[model samples]
Target: MYLKDVPRTDPNIDPATLLQLARDVLETEAEAIRQLAPRLGEPFVQACRLLLACRGRVVVLGMGKSGHVGGKIAATLASTGTPAFFVHPGEAGHGDLGMITPQDVVLALSNSGETSEILLILPMIRRLGVSLIAVTGDPASTLARESDVNLDASVEREACPLGLAPTASTTATLALGDALAVALLHTRGFSRDDFSRSHPGGKLGRRLLLHVADVMVKGERMPTVGHAASLAEALLEITRKGLGMTAVVDADGRAVGVFTDGDLRRVLEKVDNVRTVGIAEVMTQGGVRIGPDLLAAEAAQLMERRRINALLVEDSDGRLVGALNMHTLLDAGVI
Candidate 1:
């Protein structure tokens, strides 16, 4: 496994120097991507516009390392509001070209702008009359010249010591792909819910889709006591419901405030006869409340932000319908 022109590392090079060499590679690649920033101008916008207007999918094509990047770019585009998929140029020559159509847009990647396999497919793509967008290092090469839009993903130098490996250039192309995907996402107003729909098996989907109603203890399971109830009565309800808190409702069975273990502790410190105190006198009035339809993650966020452990769920009529806590959220995997 020898690469031409690559230097053999001196075994004498200390561990510190070896680590520094690795760090330099990362820094060089970062700078290369930084240099790519100014090169993104009208061409990038034109590429996005073409993809946006396409009635069919964005067909990404590349060879070698560029193919790997193209696959990831296609996945990102497809998941982020753009319809796209990658087709290997080698496979395309072997009849996979049928996957593309004139209604689609072709995204071709080649660092040298002269990948033979990609070059081989140019005629078939043109024959189909689909617009071509080239992401390449060479702006004046054959691929660029033939493209309807040429995005300059050129880098000043490769991070490889021999300046041969597809290091910096590949990173820049991936960043450019991400930029395009995010831009399209913004224009299409893609939301967390939409992303959740595409990735329902992931935690992000559960966070966005799980609502308070789905995780809350509703109906008779909810812990409640009248505001006029004594501290002993409120404690009985809280202990019975195992929520560490009980809603203090009014005569209409609508919640007005909440009494928690924390409040009970405070009341005990101030009053010797805790049983004499009414929940209305000690309960927190109109405690931070949420609707049943509120996202469970939002509920968790509110409880986290307010440094509380539980949330009281209320209906449109302001009646206490349910309750949830950190435990409930964790049990439902919404945290």
Candidate 2:
């Protein structure tokens, strides 16, 4: 314990005093991240290269609090297109060391660079010939010296008033792990489609991967009515298709406009004979449409901007291909 000026613990600390202390701790940690920004250079790039070249997964290892951080880092890497998984150094000695293959990369995290459990497994990893990327606060520590690439996650000080707890150091290490993952993601050309494949069960995945073709109501079920058809016929098509709207197509099977329930209401207000009115008179000409390749998220944004619930899907030549609405997007988890 150091920093004698600050008390170890105050049982009766006031709410205002506690708030200020929390702010101070946050500011200290923020400064630690800023300091780590400049330290990213060759060693950091080397770690990315090693990971990118790794044919097998990246095996993350750490002890105590660092182990918790390592697990999160592993998850982030795996989700971002970098193959990785975490293994407890303590458990590795018992049996988990088999997870480290010759083609894999080992990222060991230890603030002090002298964790007993991590050091014990060093010889086994070395014998396997797996590349080692060491993350530590001490540049001269044994872990750093022996690593294939050393990332200096050193922080000036800990946010802990006693200066013994791992606070700023762990933050720096976590940030470094993120940097490596993002770098590898960029080098591997990890597109949104690629990221979505790794996360198919969540809203983020659906928004990125779900396309108009994937959810659009295609084939015979698509609501379509001839441009010369009566308004009543269009209404019947809408009802039968259950899409709340119908595409008005010309003789060439090309959509010229769209007629929705809102259009029906307006027609009824002005025209007494709904059955006799032509579909073209009440349809929205050159209406907003989307392609089958457009992402469902993009389609949702367009619908929100245009203030409409449904859109007509058309091919390159203006042929009606499919139909989709807000409900379709919701069903696909894109909304």
Candidate 3:
């Protein structure tokens, strides 16, 4: 597609000017985020403590652009160990307020703290005896006045030339929300394992964590054959298990060689009678293997680097205990 086809910018605008406009906006908002660091005082600490001590879910509410930021903050909190959800101010009055209980905390966001929808729900929230927290540019607004705690998401000015669009203010509010979530995360001593549990489908959950034992084939599903078995016997085990390979084990049940479908084709070229050949004679010795305790993602990396599929899962004693293949990785969402 041609650059002129893009809808956001004027077709005749200079590319450098467009880039500079975006850069300026980002720089101004970045400065706004930086300024929020020193402003974290007693109120911020108390907000973190309240969120940490919350027994019920965090119900975030706002209108317009503040609602968008509130939704994002709720998602971040929910994914990072804090149970939370967004409650649109308009919807809360239309029966969605049933989702909130007295044990829950309501975090309301409004730049002027006078957003009609959010202000309208203040009475219902108070009547439910729910704890109230407000994020606003104005501390004197009704939302802040009625809140149990107030978070100042105020900014000096917006990056927009019109000074109407939410730019610096939204950035500051987002940064403050992140600070609260992170502080609560630290105070709760949330670990990477806990984070992974919450994000099992994400890339971060796959890389630094998730173990092979959590995804590998085991017991009767694993393909194995005695070291003295014929190539045909090994092939039968591979076909029966459908892992594309069979682990050959010694008399002591230790892995000695692995016979894959690739090995079968290669051996067929060299052996006059493949059916009579011993698997040990045709198999690759000391093939790439992994421990069941290893990460499934690490196994994928190893297989990719070595240009192979299927790994014999060995115990610490080198005894074959399990087996896994590319299909297993795919099934476990490790691919």
Give all TM-scores, in the order shown: 0.88, 0.89, 0.77
User: Over the stretch 1-335, how does candidate 2's per-residue lDDT look in tens digits?
Assistant: 12344465857756776677778888889999999988889988888888988999999999988999999999999999988999999999999998788999999999999999999999999999999999999999999998998999999999987798899999988998898889888999998888888988888878888889999998998999998999889989999999889999999988899988877887788999888889999899967899988898999999999999889998787678998988889988898
User: Residue-wise lDDT of candidate 1 within 1-335, one digit each (tens)?
Assistant: 11323347655756666677777788988998888878788988898799889999999999999999999999999988898999999999999999998899999999999999999989989999999999999999899999999998888888776788899999999999999999999988998888877777767778978889989998888899986899889989999999888888989988899888888888888888768888888999988799999899999999989999988998898878899889999988887
Cα lDDT of all candidates, in order? 0.89, 0.90, 0.85
Could you tell me the lDDT of residue 237 within candidate 1? 95
Global local distance difference test of model 1 = 0.89
In model 3, what lDDT does residue 7 have? Answer: 56
Q: Which 10 successive residues of model 3 have the least lDDT summed?
A: 1-10
* Candidate 1 local lDDT, residue 294: 83
Q: Candidate 3: where is the Cα deviation over 4 Å?
A: 1-11, 200-214, 217-225, 229-245, 259-295, 301-310, 315-319, 325-331
> How does model 3 fare in lDDT?
0.85
What's the distance in Å from true for residue 160, model 1?
0.9
Predicted structure with the largest lDDT when compared to the true one: 2
Better of 1 and 3 by lDDT: 1
Q: After superposition, how far is residue 193 of candidate 3 from its true place, in Å?
A: 3.8
Root-mean-square deviation of every model: 3.1, 2.9, 4.9
